[model samples]
Target: MDLFPPDKILVDRVKNGDREAFTTLMERYQQKVFQTSMGFLHNQADAEDLTQEVFIKSYKSMKSFRGESSFGTWIYRITVNKAINQLRRNKLRAFAGLDAMKGEDSAADTNADAPLLRKEQKEQIKDALTKLNNAQKKVFVLFYYQELNLKEVAEVLELSPKATESLLFRARKNLQKELD
Candidate 1:
């Protein structure tokens, strides 16, 4: 039988002395983690750094993984929280340079100005996103950027569907106000 085990089993092993289990976990989710970070930070370098940081932080706190949620959901929460922290630590990073970032990780976006958006609009959107408190930003990123459904977002955030729905509503309202 394959002794490699699954994510939950890896978590169990990690809680024990099997450090390789964590490596397995990292290998499984590194890309997803990096992409999520990219969505939040919009910079490949920052996203890569944050992905490593998330795994390291998870290693330190592996004991807390109680299997209440899927390992992906658990790690996503960690990723979101760490990305928020990165945003807080460097609020000076401007989204005005989003064109540069877009080139670095071009994936064929359908935005009106995907190749080169108006700097002012990018700045306005970034400013609006930043103005959202942590809660709103989390919901906005997960739903809009990550394209997660309401139930999945609620699962990751550990909130009821109704609460998550309320968050999305408020986030839309707040973002519309900012863009207007």
Candidate 2:
């Protein structure tokens, strides 16, 4: 007897009104979803919120899943779309000066005593990522931050493998230019 069923089985169970099956799926994918969300939003609180939102949306739309792609790929597509939309909303808030009212420091608040060089590198990378076009940024984040392979990134982005590779190449080149 298997301790854990496959994602396809769990997905079917969720579609058939099995709430526990959905929870099992959530436990399996939540970390990856959170990490992917953080890769785009660059804020822990926002990423956590986005993670919850992604699962809620997925749960509501479970019946629409066609299984054309793997469950992981489908969930990742949702995470990416939600994260992009959140980024757009954040930009609008910043432009309106509402973000300043939140009184959140923009600096890396993860570690106070971290080495200066490491901190600067992280800032530089984050800045460089902002400069990328949306396609390049998506490919870069999915491939590097989410640790998805080229094929998986292609599947999630609904791009051909060659196209995904091209975007990743461009992203790396742009980042190099910005960092240098």
Candidate 3:
């Protein structure tokens, strides 16, 4: 017998009020959801918080899941929406000067400068991602960070494969321009 049940079976169990089944589902996708959230927010704590939010929202709405797409795709859609909203909230806080009051952490880095360089590069990439349009950002994040193939990205974004490819191309071009 297979040690793991399929997601469809698990979804059915959850619909029947099996909380352990829902927990199993969460274990299956939590890391992917966290990576998706991190790709958008670029902050660990924010990503973790968003991951919890995604699972909570998923649990609440599991009954409404039409299974039109795969369970992973459905959860990814939720993560993307929540992460984007969080980014918008952060932007609003910055625009209102509230972010400034939070202040930066001044942890002493006794290590070498290599980590600093990598951190700077990571920040640059994050900024470049932010410059992308919403569609392009979604494509880039799903394809690269979440490691979804073009077809999977398309399914998540509800775009044709050709459209997803074009958006990905434009996103790469724009990101190259931004980084340069």
Candidate 4:
């Protein structure tokens, strides 16, 4: 059963000091936060922990949420920032433990297999994406995977639409080069 009618309803309830309403908001958005984190961190445990942190932080700051943007978008922005920070830390740690991260060991899923050229293509894409600079990767993921339009992407990234477009262009060029 749904704990609240909708996010807006819950947001109003939360603004009125209803903890349960806030919990509902967390429940509704947790998987999205986790997936967003995973797209950057690529580790289940870390992603899960970060998702939890994102909600906790959001809940604590709920009083300040003055409906500037939709609550969902605000939460998404928080999750992305948390994920980016983790990615930065991960890059630093990568140098310290070179052996463990090698060849599928640190990949998001250590599953069995998918088959054929599509699987190869998927792997290639993942590899290419990882090679992108952070700014380019951010635009690529937000635009391509999250399906945000250029304007929405700009809002999230705090970039001009033109800058976001250029980042995406460079990102795609880099990916295509890596794939070839």
| Better candidate number, 2 or 3, judged by lDDT | 2
Model 2: CA > 4 A from native:
101-108, 115-118
Cα deviation in Å at residue 46, candidate 3?
Answer: 0.2
Output the worst ten-in-a-row residue range by lDDT, candidate 1: 103-112
7-58 in candidate 3: lDDT tens per residue?
Answer: 9889989999999999999999999999998788776777899999999999
Tens digits of per-residue lDDT for model 4 on 13-124? 8989999888878878887777777677665777798998899899888889888777878887888888888777777677677536553554435444655565566677
For 43-123, candidate 2 gives per-residue lDDT tens digits of: 788889999999999999999999989999999999999988988898899899998854245554666677989878877
**lDDT for each residue of candidate 1 in 93-162, tens digit (9 for 90 to 100):** 4355535554434333324454455655675676788788888788888888678899999999989999
lDDT of 3: 0.86
Give RMSD to native, each candidate.
4.9, 1.7, 2.6, 3.3
Candidate 3's C-alpha runs over 4 A off are 101-116
True lDDT of residue 82, candidate 4: 81
List, in order, the clash count of every candidate structure. Answer: 0, 0, 0, 0
Which is superior by TM-score, 2 or 4? Answer: 2
lDDT over C-alpha atoms for residue 39 of model 4: 72
Query: After aligning candidate 2 to the native by TM-score, how far in Å is the CA of 141 from where it should be?
Result: 0.8
Pick out the ten consecutive residues of candidate 3 with the lowest summed lDDT: 103-112
Clashing pairs in 1: none
* Decoy 2 TM-score against native: 0.93
Ranking by lDDT: 2, 3, 1, 4
